[model samples]
Target chain A: MAFGIGSGIFFAHMPFLKLNGIPGTTYRVMPGLISKRLTNRLGINFQAESFGNNRQKGMDELDRVLDRGFPVGMLTSVYYLPYLPKAFRFHFNAHNLLIYGKQNGEYLVSDPVLDFTTTISPKDLERARFPKGVLAPNGRMYYPVSVPEKVDFNPAIKKAIRWSGFENIMTPPFLPFFGSRAINYMANKVAKYPTAMDERKAILFLGNIVRMQEEIGTGGAGFRFIYAAFLQQAAKRLDNPELSLLSKEMTGIGDQWRDFAFSAGRICKGRQAGNEDFKSIANLLMDIGDKESAFFHKLRKVKM
Target chain B: MKANEVPQDDSGVIGGKFTGLKYATDENGNYVEVQSIGWDAEITVLSQAWDEVNEQAKEALEKVKAGQWSTLAYHSTKCMMNEAMLSEYMDMSKAKVKEHLYNPAAFAALPAATKEKYAEVLNIDLNELLRAE
Candidate 1:
């Protein structure tokens, strides 16, 4: 029933997997929160192998099973290659995915990275090698294998593999979920609303403004320093005694504000200085601001 | 539909002026689309710069030149992805932009010098670019 529920949802959502595709499953050896969510949805058992120990022991256990002619499922390597007995070296990353049923003297393997369903001959499996640094200090790998029957539970082994309480196989990664697509479609629909567009434009403008500030800290340092020096000179220009003392003070403050504003403008200008997207977006914002100001002026005139 | 009507389909939205201008037809008959202008342009610029620096570095094999190239590329990419103009144009989430740029497949086609040039133009580090898994 558990498998049925998971499979039903998985199969329903991702019909693309059935189009000239092989049936397969996915599992995470060391399940993180995201992996746990996947497990719940897919009904896959979370078999947690330790990065520190037990991985070698698990590999050994797998080898024993393979020797007994039990169909092997893909091994999920959380960290480092499990120490499989020499006979199983052929399966290292080659028949990396084990098949439950053989059609043409080859096991169908599902590769996550390759995004293709591959059929590997036993000879090819023999020559397959683990990735470089697979045996190193902190390397991690995950494999999916075919099993003769549901994985038998040795209490300790089950405990080691059961990172999460859930236990069911998951659909392969290539499967598409209709629910997600639907949600995305709806979101794109909502984005077309004028209010949403305006909000997006505003947020984009604000984000650009913030980014411009950060750029000045990096590549715009020269311009910033020059702008600062210019402000200092402007401040010095307010040294006229002929003007009222308060006027002179006001002039100094004005000069300081001018410098600050100029520095800010320089930083903003420097951000999209050469980038066309920035130029366009900046122009759009300016146009929007101008239109808004004009609208306000027209409203005031009408009120008068 | 009226000109101001909200676009209900991909074609309507995609054909809109803002989005339409983002793509262009190249001489090779491929549609070259600008995913993110500021960020891509910055990368192009940094990549160009790195090409020069790398040519000199290869002759001298100077670590400093290499380091400068790396820093330039890294800073630019980071700035581009994190900053507003480039980030907004990204097809994926903002967080994923950095990862996408770092992906090996993205640079697989470029030669070492060309890749370095691209990094310089983008204001990123070559080592960092290569290291992106």
Candidate 2:
């Protein structure tokens, strides 16, 4: 049910970049923004509202919605979600999940990051919804206020493709921390980790990238596979074989991301050395940047 | 992303948190249903992060015991937060929160309304908020 939301289905957010000497450069455009953009473009009627300071009222509204048979999308802190394994939990607060129904005192949850649905107590749900962090959920929730019986697919597909491709490849010159440039910026920062911070800190930093990519549903391969899936759908919808080929290429790029994560993991565990230095890691990232740059560059030129 | 690949072994740590029904391809490349049990490496990383939090909580508890910081500080750390985070959560200015951290007497004397806000934000009871431990 949550998969119908366009954010995770379309472009995967690649928001791991920072300005030099700046702390907390890890930011994404986020699912909320994407949902808004896609829904607006497709003219799919939806409403995403933040409950802000009145969390009790938010809970009431969520109960009302669930009673009305709408599975509501909610922003929450992964760390406070008690159902998640403690080892998989982190401070990230922008995690999205669906609250479909309630029984007894527990809310049925459909977390996109997981492979199966789960349940959470109202108390834990409340805690997860309101967590202290950089990107606190603030009791934010979204739902499809209304959806079209039939979607006009051609324009939607074209627009989504164009928007995603342009956003990732041809980001404005003023925004240095975007698109391929952001990847380059991250590569530079990662290369300096060994010298810029203590050894243990450096490895933790490496581990965080893996955590973001694989553990937190950041899309295994930084969202390349999801984008590929989107392209695959586009290929079928538009009857364009080029898109299918591009999807295969994107999947290969996703493989590269997995490889990077695997290497990073080994280094974090101190199991691999001699060839897994910071420089090599940086180079691997640059290779991804190159492939992504080429892919998006070509994607933007698709005739549709 | 296969049913067989889902690790059922939860020998040493917590398990049984079901995600959702996932789709995987069989040997014939046809879609199949699978239930992901949870990734082991991701759990290990989460455990490591929790250990760090536990260490911080222990330090904060000692400070509370010594009257160097308010019990609120220790509780905040226990909630996986620091002063900056607690300030954000409580919707109080960082400077004010920091002041409260240093002055347990003042914190204890705060209005019930304000105390309630802290307890609610931390997802704890009022008694737990005031407790020294």
Candidate 2 error regions (>4 Å): A1-28, A67-69, A102-106, A113-124, A271-276, B1-44, B61-67, B102-120, B125-133
**What's the lDDT for residue B15 in model 2?**
52
Tens-digit lDDT track for model 1 on A37-90?
444444454443323333454445544444555544443321112222221121
Q: Which tens-of-lDDT digit does each residue in A1-304 have in candidate 2?
A: 1222243332222334221112333323554776776687677788777777677988998999888888899999887887776655656778889999998889999887666789999888887887766677789998887888887767777776766667776777666566766666678778887777777567666666666565545434555555666676678778998877777777777777667776776676663333348889888888887888888787778877
Candidate 1, fnat value?
0.00
List ranges where model 1 is wrong by over 4 Å: A1-35, A53-109, A113-273, A276-304, B1-133
Candidate 2 matches the true fold with a TM-score of 0.81
User: What C-alpha RMSD separates each model from the true structure?
Assistant: 26.1, 4.4
lDDT of 2 at B100: 80
lDDT of 2 at A199: 72
